[model samples]
Target chain A: MKIIVSLFTFLICQLYTLAQVNQASMYGLDTSFLNYNTCELGAIHEYFSYHAKYPESTMSLLKRVQDSVVSHPIALSKNGFITFRFTVNCQGKASHFKLYLLDENYAETIFDKTLVLFLYDFIKGLNGWKIIKDKSGQHILNYNSYFSFQIKDGKIISVAP
Target chain B: MVKLYLWLLSLCLFCFNNSNASAQEVVVSKIDCLDSKWQESAEQGLFHAQYATGYMSEEWQSHCDSLLHICPNFSYIWEMKAMPHIKGGIYDFASLNKAVSINPNRQLPYRAFMKCIFSKDYYGALLDLDSAEQLVHGGGIMDHSFSFYKGISYLSIGKADSAVLYLQKDVAEQSKRMGLGNEHYNSLFYLGLAHLYAQQTKQAERYLLASIKAYSKFPEPNYYLGILYLQKNERLKAKTYFQMAQSALNNGYNMNEDNNIYVDYPFQISAVEIEQVLKE
Candidate 1:
């Protein structure tokens, strides 16, 4: 009788462990849910610092403007990534900005007109960047960047490296 | 007394067995739901695969490849694969044609419609849409996606009246069924285009704005906004929208190429026809 009882308890514990394993493997734990605070602005600043060292020639300026837009400025408190592409003309005028948020949770919650407008204004302000002309002599700049952010304890954290 | 005890023991064993079976059934059901979740994840992966750059990490590619291997006839996976090809300026007529051929009775018509649109063969696309409509009618395979594409195809062929009719119907029904996703936004977009083509600028503006509201990330609304601005002689605004469209297209957004839709008006464009346009 004692052995039987011990065996039953062992079976129950085994089943519980199996259930947990299934749950963990099935729905990935949200790592961004953990508390971690880091600022994306530091990385952005570093990028710009290195970029600023490039010659202010037409091509270099065009690249600088493109880099600025691609480096996402805003961070969210979730595992999210955004990509933006834009062009700065030969005269250092930013135009044709496109931003896309690829995070499902962020898309549902954070992407809104207010945020989009803010991003647009930010890009437009960098109108002083240089541009490179294509073979057709059309001055255009293009780039893409990925940024992830998380918020913990009511404070925003940048988790993108 | 021994006989009575044996009977009681049998009864208890029977009841215990039944309860255990019920518990097992519940466990099975939970397992099924878990399996369904995996399938959903696979579907999402396929959807994103369409926009994946050619330089996909080995891990991501293997994950998607495993899903495709398990569900070879999954039409969405094939469709997703076709998209990156189109975006990267690689035309895979064979894969797209196969996708439609394999699932003619399914949502393959939508894929066929996209192929025809990308190729700038509006007439061919309309024919495919007609076939798709027939299949739906034959067996009651009612999906708002078909009507959405149908409307766009009509608009591309310069059939503004038909476009409006189909898209308005789609919008009404989709809204009722709460089908407001990418397809819903598209229906709204083509409806706006139909209005613009019909010279109803006020109505066009309303629908276009509604489309933008529905899915701001969609480039179609912004593209039409540019056109609307051009019509109103707001060149600067128009230029901004056009630039937005161009940027969106380059960054993995699929553009409908029916009727040679171009970021810059009067300039012919196709997903893979960028090289030709650039040359010109």
Candidate 2:
């Protein structure tokens, strides 16, 4: 009985440590919620920082890929928005991916695990991100970037900002 | 040496006093309300909020929340707090709706603009803009007339006929205000798009040419005109416009709107898309 109690306490401590891993940054960024990976390097700026951009204008290409890749399941008729938030380092590599799902009213919601994982992998595989440049066209900086997808009846209707 | 130190100290004091006076002036010049005491508090709150490093930072949110605690009915504070969330796609509607409830005339146009641009809620945006028009006698907001935004919102939701009506009104109003042939390039571009989608190809061609004439480097209208020409089997004209669009995009010309930093405008095209058309 004594040995079993000690084993239970050990398990509880492990679980508590796992829960505490997600802490807020100085900027109050929720660092670990639904994060696919947590390997951010150096300091990062927000996507809305001055003159940030992707390497090229290929968002329509991305939309085309999404339309072709996501196979619709009849059971997955949920309509909402899925936001993928991540950071691109100064070298333009993306990491620290996070996901948030919301209904039309902007309330938090859930999605199918298969759909979520597919999106996670899709965002993770995206490359050729560009580092933000200052107005003078000098000084490269890392920044966070995000894109949201509007889904209707298991199909992506549009992608935004 | 002692005399030089004393002079330096006096200069420092003068500079500090001057800066402090300017800070106070900034607050006073920006805020004015009927109640003097409330106005003072509001100004101080705004001054402190402005010191935060980034608008989307939690520090900014907390400062806005603290000010709201004291002046719960402050509509501008609610609007300011909602901005970062909207841009980030966090999508909290309570704060923005609260602002609209408090001061409809001042806040409704702003809410409509955000809904149309950031959230892509076309129906919701139309409702808010309609309210704003009734209250403010059809004034503009965020550098666009209500008819201009309504036109875009209608086009977004596939209502081409309504888009044409409002866009025509916008063109007439803007031409009356800014003189003939001086309407905004965007108004003309969108009006052209509406005509194209409504199957009026000749009107589309006229306004699209007008858009490119107004702003030579504009890319979207060029690409659409290429499509229109391609459909008519005018491959040579289509290729010229496609190359023009590609060249403009390569030179970093884009939808030159102020809010595009936060969101892509509806129907905005890209360099890759233009290239694809050229290949076709």
Candidate 3:
């Protein structure tokens, strides 16, 4: 059984600034701009590499997530990755699904609508992203999360943070 | 007379046995939040439960005994045990050294933040608070306090802009945490002071006055209000606020009731500054 190491580390810095500066005009993340959650990037991958589920309390849930990843089989090229970015609204429901197929350097590549549908459906199925609202209580601040997959042949080999 | 003496002796013996039976009953009772379960739990090696009970108890000796019974090698216990000392304004580095050695994720940042503040390491305090914030799972009292201290530490280091940034965020977060109508008076007061230091007079006045309006008995806001009016060249209004601050000198800035430790940081220093201004 392949172990899927997921960091679930979605950088929310863009939301941190835009939430305060211009809440009304903010949108989902773009690949062009840099992500600040990069601080834990290297350590997170290495930490999860050997250690799968952690902190004891969330072990069952994480174990279940990893189990599901292995169960679902996906077709892919020799190398590259598939990514899905979504906006988890103030209610914690994942929405506004945006799919991306990228090369090793992370440049976006075009994919068929069916492949996009497959990724979107999977990301929309996720249930645990934390939602935080602005102080005014009138608007919902959006936090971004990603579900990234490393593909080998017709199955998933590993997962990105 | 001999018969009466013998009867009295028998009654005394009966009463002694009755009290001993009562003590036995107390010993066998189920331990909960009340009574002296902490010592028992500690002796049983229930370390986490012992830590929790010691944390909430009034008797320090029993708590200290419980702390001692634990294996001091785990820094989490040392950190938990150190809470009372830190709260009472006494800093003990032995326990802190043990804690710093382990650097346990959950409790370390919170205690280390206190340690940094004790050492007057404002920048270090900021970094510890950031680490605590990232690792903290929920919106607990520590999270709110970290937000408050983040601002205060920046202000202490004379970084008014950065101070204002965190203080504003803290006030907003506190207000939300306290519910819609409730406001964090001391936090708002500091936010106003931060704004004043940052040269944003209008926002300063708004927040300071809001704090005074929230709790008129609080002296810091009144004293700072005086400073605010003085900046505007309104001597009479400044004098009014200064007198108000003087009257409330004994009424120190209230301590945060919601945090783990009972800490007090009054704004009495402002009184000296006001006096100097008045004399000039």
Candidate 4:
């Protein structure tokens, strides 16, 4: 019994150490929860600092959106602004690809599919995120991102970085 | 429980060693433009394999033998390089500038503009917005403002006349396209306010009333209409408009309502701006 316990303890420690292995940064997200409540969702969304060191530019993410709006001008959709939150685990794996949120009274429609596809494909095609770890260097964090779009009357007027 | 814990621990140890050995590192190898691959991808067209690289795209005879993983393109590589510091869906200024410098056609500035707007960095957004405008013109010319952002950015920067020029164009074009939709009402409403701030009361009143006609539930036009009546010393009319404004604010719902664009745009009215007159 003692030997087994000792072995188990050793295994646990080994596992913990592995989780701490430093990873080179990469583009990913932390989608730990599937049905997050509103408050939880808001908090998760706010977790990322708007401006941080070595920051990413929005150019690659939002250009096509701005172009669409300019090419075909419309207004805000019935849903107001549709926000899609993509979460990836620290291992550079996609945890949640299509987590979408919308205004209080809006209904989902076919156009939303297009929006989701664009975002998913864009994210999947992206490469070269270095690595992510907490201050303690513990491999216990996930990266997150939220992209929002405002479409109305079949017009995609605005998209956010 | 003991076995499971032990298994987890062993797995963790193995994983730790594995990660150390397989850690992705930036390849700082040099590229020789004289190489055939380099000329083909980097010079011929903006091909992915030529100018960009990642640790994963490690080709033995990589472009100029840089040992660099060929990237999708310069734009993607630049964006990926700047991805470390990003949070909250907003981009930092430095990275934004870099992205634009590398690829003028990419949407870096516009992304920065949208980020700035959310972060309430109006001045920063103006700079990005202008960059976006310039880039668009570089490739193709647009007769209208960059889809209301120019006008909104101007208004946020407190340049009402400049805003009026853009907003007026948006209001006219958008109104024609949507036929009094919420967006149309919103443009009209802002144009009216822009006129009001510029002290063009007549223009302000006309647009404000027009905005109100287009969207009855929108509280802004009513609130501003009240201010307009008060400016004319029509106390009874002003008082009526104010009551209507208040009623609109308390009302059930108009999914398409307009409010201030900054601090409280298309949502909540600025009590401070309106209260000054109410105090009278």
Residue-wise lDDT of candidate 3 within B137-244, one digit each (tens)? 332244356767778778866789998988888887767778754677778888999999999999999998988888887667888888889899998999898877
DockQ per candidate: 0.02, 0.25, 0.01, 0.06
Residues A85-116 of candidate 1 have per-residue lDDT tens digits of 33333334433333434332212223434334
Candidate 2 per-residue lDDT, tens place, B1-280, comes to: 4344333323333333355555444443433344555545554445555664467677667656655543568788788888877787666566888889998999999999988888777777899899999999778898889999999999987899899999989988989999989998899999999999898999999889999999988998999999889988999999999999989988989779988777778788877687777777
Q: What is the lDDT of candidate 4?
A: 0.49
Error of 4 at A134 (Å): 28
Please list the residue runs of candidate 3 whose C-alpha ends up more than 4 Å from where it truly belongs after superposition.
A1-161, B1-40, B43-70, B73-76, B80-90, B100-105, B116-119, B137-143, B178-181, B251-271
Per-residue CA lDDT of model 1 for B26-64, tens digit only, reads 333432222445446556544454356232233334433
- Determine which window of 10 residues in candidate 1 chain B has minimal summed lDDT: B259-268
Candidate 2 segments whose C-alpha is farther than 4 A from its true place: A1-41, A55-62, A69-76, A133-140, B1-52
Query: B1-280, model 4: which lDDT tens digit per residue?
Result: 4344333323333333344333222111233324455434432222343244322222212331221133323443344333322223222333444556767666555454434355334455566667776677522112224645667667755688998887787776665766655446667787888888778999999888888887787777888889888889998899787777766756732325221111123223533334545677
Candidate numbers sorted by DockQ from highest down: 2, 4, 1, 3
> Which residue runs of candidate 1 sit more than 4 Å off their true CA positions?
A1-161, B1-87, B137-144, B179-183, B212-280
Fnat, model by model in order, equals 0.00, 0.34, 0.00, 0.10
Give the number of the best model, judged by TM-score. Answer: 2
Q: What is candidate 2's lDDT per residue for A39-110, written digit by digit as tens?
A: 334456787665565543435744664675556542347887667676676566666556667766655676
TM-score order of candidates, top first: 2, 3, 4, 1
Candidate 1, residue B154: CA error in Å?
Answer: 2.4
